[model samples]
Target: MIDSAVALPQGRRQRNKARVQERLFEAAVELIARHGYDNTSIDEIAARADVARGTFFNYYPRKDDLISEWSARRGTELRRSLVTEAGGLEPGDTVSRFHRCLAALVELNEDRQEVNRSMVTAAVRAGCLGARESATAELFTAILTDGQARGEIGEGLDPDRLGLLLRDAYLGVLTRWAVGAEQDHASLYRELHEVFKVFLIGALPRTAHRDCCPHTA
Candidate 1:
């Protein structure tokens, strides 16, 4: 098994394994939704999934592994949204795409502060935040790389470096909101958009910058 999982399920055995994992993940999510992540026990999750407590470990070696899956599904959904929300497969300008990404992030957790707080807190406790942050950076890198290919971002800019910078700034906003820096969803949305604007000031191509800030030209 690769990283405690089959790389891909080609046979009935692997397919069955995948289905069991899906059940475990959904069960954990339901419990975490009702009870805080920390308060939810593996035994409870297993019972909710109709599996023995030991069976849960067969799929998820650790409880945090389930949490990681829970967290990653959201990220995968958000990335898919960047296209689906834009209508079909055509991508928009990188600037607008980036904006949409951050906007969706706020909307994703805005109404569920307690849930978001609980999950993020649990992720931190599980020491998985760094992995999550790395995933975000990887997404940003892909976005920047796409932009560069489309001639939207500067050719000289290092996509990896810029991506990490954007990730840091992007997560910084969420970090504050997650910790109650923003009192409500509306407040969090505003900060996310505002921070994205600030990031764009430097992130934009020189020519594009002039267009955005006409007076600067």
Candidate 2:
């Protein structure tokens, strides 16, 4: 059975709630950036946002929720960019498509360097700030699976392991860039692309010396 009774003020209250939530999220980001994750408190965020402490609780059960929300939003944006960029690439173009995706991700991070640095620092410290890590890994796995099915990526490469490797490498590079590294982003990406091309495509000469199980590249 469903209750169809309506409250006249329900709609208005919902709108108000949304507005308060937005304010709380904004306040939390600012406070976290200023005070670091361990020191930032819900009461501080509420006061900074000019909302009551109860309002803060209504939006985020805890301070970490704010970080999780932010990470999820950024992950969604990255996934969208990857999908849109890879839309029409041929199977043979998988390597190029992946390079473009990596470049796009670097550019996106460059645009949000400060927030990214802060988030990475917090996540590294707290270990699990981003709930979307698994989702991002899944996205990589799908991309690799498609490439492999089409004969673009090499056979016998475990999609899950490859995905995890790529995520670690990408995050490691971004982490370095975030910490005031002056390396040229494009050059670094090109080098990595070359490595990936040789490793995944087996384009290197048979006689070329190579260690087994090189995760990078």
Candidate 3:
């Protein structure tokens, strides 16, 4: 979902540039998502975007730039879902809110063997994963802080520190998925729900109902 409204460009020329840039980036991700990243070259990305091969360089100096952009967008997706509330914010169960946030995350990661592997390789090589992790961790901290206020989350928990750990746990499962170790669960969503159980053990108040976990999310 579009997280926010974008300001219109002042000039027609600037708008055209923005459109071309978006088209190129969208084309690149679609191509990489379909074919393996390594197998998809600059030529293919440019052709798919309907731009000249040289024009691709005009927007992205190197192919890795596109990957870095994609990684940033992935991080933004988390914030968009949680902070902005794609539809509209409605107060509810903190646990359920967090579950939905995580479910959105799970939906973002592809299960396709070649595509995910290639995307992981590109993300790692681009060196943007750490930034993504940090941004996502901050969002986690925000959620935990809110949950604590609502008396749903455990007290005495360090939201900032725990947020970083949550980020680690999130990536840990993602790493497993990336490595094709998600075979235990029938599907990726199920796999994440399984892993999230461990987090709830520490996150929820001791008095919180064990049945509060939403497995269907």
Candidate 4:
């Protein structure tokens, strides 16, 4: 086995790389918010982060890659929250878990509306939000797969397609809220909640329990 001391430098290098990547994300997000995504360039991002262009590429192959990483990180955080809220993805608590995740995300975005809008614009232009191979899609697909296995959700549906649909709908609401007026944030949150409310109901198995239909009037 390799000596722990020998591996220490490698661990340090990994930590340094993560720090540099985080700085680049902060710089790029700020610039994109101020100058718009199309106008922001790699060189500018490097300059803002006070790093060389090559260093930026070492972390992210391209600007789109950076945006995808940011979106994926957010998705992972949401999944963590869902697991925590629902006690590890209990299929019967799917609707409640989704609500908790959305509420947390909305509360987060409400504090950084402009940055959220810029990020959404970049994500849309880069087509990262809908990427089938994205972490965001993978997480949702896993959720649906487990739900189906537990007979808590529709079994006939393709989990991958359903995952993409759910992701797209989420992006749509997020983008709308990011671009909408501050005064309308509450209303927009309601719209987002309603969208998922409908989705959860629709995704239920035909023989789902009455408790599964959380939106019953």
lDDT of candidate 3 over 79-118, digit per residue (tens) = 6766654543336577787788767786667534445556
Question: Whose TM-score is greatest here?
Answer: 4
Prediction 3 global C-alpha lDDT? 0.72
Range of the 10 consecutive residues with the lowest summed lDDT in candidate 3? 1-10
Q: If both were scored by TM-score, which would come out higher, candidate 1 or candidate 3?
A: 1
Clashes of 3: 0
With a 3 Å backbone cut-off (N, CA, C), the pairs that clash in candidate 2 are none
Question: Comparing 3 and 4 by lDDT, which wins?
Answer: 4
Q: Looking at candidate 1, what is the lDDT of residue 81?
A: 61
Please report the candidate that would top lDDT against the real structure.
4
Candidate 1 Cα outliers beyond 4 Å, as residue runs: 1-16, 83-89, 111-113, 202-217
Q: Relative to the unseen true structure, what is the Cα RMSD of model 1? A: 5.9
Clashing pairs in 4: none
In model 4, the runs with Cα more than 4 Å from the true position are 1-10, 84-92, 202-217
Estimate, for each residue in 148-180, the C-alpha lDDT of model 4 and write its tens digit. 787877776788998888878877887776666
TM-scores of the candidates in the order shown: 0.73, 0.72, 0.72, 0.75
Q: Tell me how far the alpha carbon of residue 9 in candidate 1 is from the true structure, in angstroms, after superposition.
A: 11
- The CA lDDT of each predicted structure is 0.73, 0.67, 0.72, 0.74
Model 2 agreement with the true structure over 1-217: per-residue lDDT tens digits: 5322234345777768767878887887787666666678778988999988887777788666776788776776767766655453333366666766666666666664556667766765566523335555666777788888888776868888887776666665555665655666475566556545654556556666376558755
Relative to the true structure, candidate 4 reaches a TM of 0.75
Please identify which of the two predictions, 1 or 2, would achieve the higher lDDT against the true structure.
1
